[model samples]
Target: MPTTIRYSISDLATYFESTTYDRIMVLCDENTRTHCLPLLTKWIPHFQIIEIASGETHKNWETCMQIWEALVANHFTRNSLLINVGGGVITDMGGFAASVYKRGIKCIQIPTSLLAMVDASIGAKTGIDFQDIKNTLGTFYEAELTIIDPIFLQTLDKRQIISGFAEMLKHGLIADKAYFHQLLDYSFENTIDWPLLIQQSLHIKSSIVAQDPTEKGLRKTLNFGHTIGHAIESYYLEKENALLHGEAILYGMIAALFLSSKKFNYTSAFISALENFTEKHLSTAKIKIDITQVMKYIQQDKKNKGDQFLFVLLDAENQILYDIPCSQNEIIEALNYLHD
Candidate 1:
């Protein structure tokens, strides 16, 4: 069965009251500790805290060791529940640690960031970066539940919110045409109904994730912009506050849309709207990684089979097509198109 996703404090309180869990803990980062932690303290005042360094760079084995060591010191058992609070890094790392700690345990996701609430926190995948690739080490353990309260988004900065919007754009492009149109017209500068939009995005992704929990077929569509997006993320990860995952993805969406137009005869109006949006909001830092470097990372993408690069491309009508083999030269041309 699919895990229940709720958007209320009462639901969270009910879970905390459950006798199924013998112990409870929160895995968070420095930023989440300062900004988002207090929101949970009222409900989970006695819950153990597992704080770790923030950022995609720290989503590694070393950090996993920190979580594992903390649980050990606290004598956490299989009946213990770990609620992952914060964005992608904390949920990914926390889920991984909880799933593998003695084979398996219970995990609940409390997604504070827009990206996590809408996308990352919904999927059952748990992984940490290994070698130079993204999400290279992980498992298929699903979370027991995910709590997404829009109130936590108030703690996020504008950049983080915009970064999260990128995935929403991808969600629209891949699933709902009306939603794609809605996103095209949606403005990030002003306030809107976040709870509504969050539900919309989560439904699209969750439906896909449920069908292909193992990512064998339909689930691969969720990786729409990630093929190149993840490579760009890897290339620039070392830089200070460098491209957050969604920024690189917005850049990749630019390239993917370009390829979609060229290869699939995608409508000019839709493509142009996306292009104009990119021109207005995104900057060249979005693709500061040299073409060669991005390509090198793409070659290492886990989705690629053997020597060929497999891309999930969209049709002119915005329908998704997976595992389409893309050539290096064609990819370079797409980069040139994105640059232009």
Candidate 2:
């Protein structure tokens, strides 16, 4: 079953109170432990805290072991509850850790970032990076409940908000052209109706996840920007100032849009609009890395089948086309297009 998603604190409180568990633990990172956890404490006051280092670099086996050790040290059982509170890293790693501990355990997702609220925390997909690959190891472990409260968004800075908005834009690009354009029209400088935008993005993603929970087919469309995006993300993961998932994805989306325009008969005007909007709002042109190294990472992407590189590109009507095979030259060209 699709996990229950609640936008109301009262709903989360009611569910939390009704559920019986042997123990309760809230898994969070340093950033969230400082900024986001206190908000959750009002509704869920009694729980052990498992704190880990923040960032994509820390989302790996070593951290997973740390989580497992904490669970073991705390005597967590299959009946225990783990509440994941933070951004994508926390939700993804926490869900993976809880899913594996004692085979499986109950989990509650309280996504505290715009990205987590709209994407990571909604889907049952849980994963951690392995050997520099993004989400190379994980599971489809559904949380018992997912609470998306926009209040936590206040803690995010402009860059973080922009990072989260990249996923929102991808939601529109993959599923609804109208939504894509609607998002383009909005100015981030002014006030945003985050509730409406968050709802629309979640609806686009959750609807896709509902049909293909295991990414059998339709769900792959959700990875529209991620094919090349993940490569860029992995390339930056080892750097001193690594790119945020959405930041790299913004570049990925730009590359994907370029590829889509070439493969499909998108009007020049439409492509122009996409370019202008991207440059204005989400461009990562200032960030430079070795395109060749990124290519190496792309070759090692988890989504690839054998030597063939699979992608989720768009057709002329803005429809999803998954498992489309693209050659190394074509992929290189697409990555080069980002530089142009």
Candidate 3:
């Protein structure tokens, strides 16, 4: 049976009330601690709170070790509840710690960022990046529930909002054509209908995640742009000072769309539509990425088996996942197209 889910601001309280657990642990970062934590404290006042430094760089085994130490010190058992209340980094690391601590425990995700609500929170795939590789160590563990409130987005900066919008665009490209069109029509600047967008994007992601929780078959489709997207993300993380996940994924989507047109023979019209939509919302910042570094990261991707790199290319109308063997030259071309 599928797990229960809710997407409302008040649902967190309701969920907290209904659950029977000895103790609850709420995880937050510095930013979320300053911004969203106060708002959440009114409802979850009695719970044990754990604050960690925020950012993708902190999502690692070292942080996980610290969480484990905290759990041990606080006498957190298997029956204890962990509520992840922040962006993807917090949710991902927190979920991972909960899953591994005492051989897995129940967790609730109260995602604050746009990216976390639509993509990271629903999937239950939790992990931290190994060195520069993205999501290197992780597990498939479903959350007991996920509570989403678009109200938290008001505190987010414009770049953060745009970053989250990239994943919503990915959700549309993979599943709903109408939703994709709707996203194109909406303005990212001032006219975003957060509630509707959150519902639609979560619906698309949850349905996909429910169907293939382990990411063994159709769920691989959810990684439509992630193969190159993740590599691009790692490359930027290693080379640059600060690049948000959504921003890298936005560029990844651009590259994937270009690859779809050139290699997969997708229509120019479709490519044009994707380009126009991305250009309107995504920034065209020139990140000087070394093709060799990106290739090394791609080769080390967990999805790759043996020597063959499994690349997910979009078909006409984005109907099916076509797994293709891509070469270094092809990847360079894709990145080059993104630069151009």
lDDT of 3: 0.80
lDDT (tens digit, per residue) of candidate 2 on 1-340: 7899999655767986677788899999989999988777778847899999988889999999999998999898888999999999999999999899999998999898888999999879999998888898999999899999898888888788878888988888888888988988888778899899999999999899988889999999988889898998898888887888888888887777677777775445645665676567555353466889989999998889999999888778777799988888888888887764
lDDT for each residue of candidate 1 in 18-38, tens digit (9 for 90 to 100) = 656677889999999998888
Instruction: Name the better of 1 and 2 by lDDT.
Output: 2
RMSD of each: 1.6, 1.6, 1.9
| Weakest 10 consecutive residues of candidate 3 by summed lDDT | 278-287
| Cα lDDT, model 2, residue 141 | 91
| Model 3 TM-score (2 dp) | 0.94
- Please report, in order, the local distance difference test score of every candidate based on alpha carbons: 0.84, 0.85, 0.80
Q: What is the TM-score of each candidate against the true structure?
A: 0.95, 0.95, 0.94
Which candidate order results from sorting by lDDT in descending order? Answer: 2, 1, 3
RMSD of 3: 1.9
Off by over 4 Å in 3: none
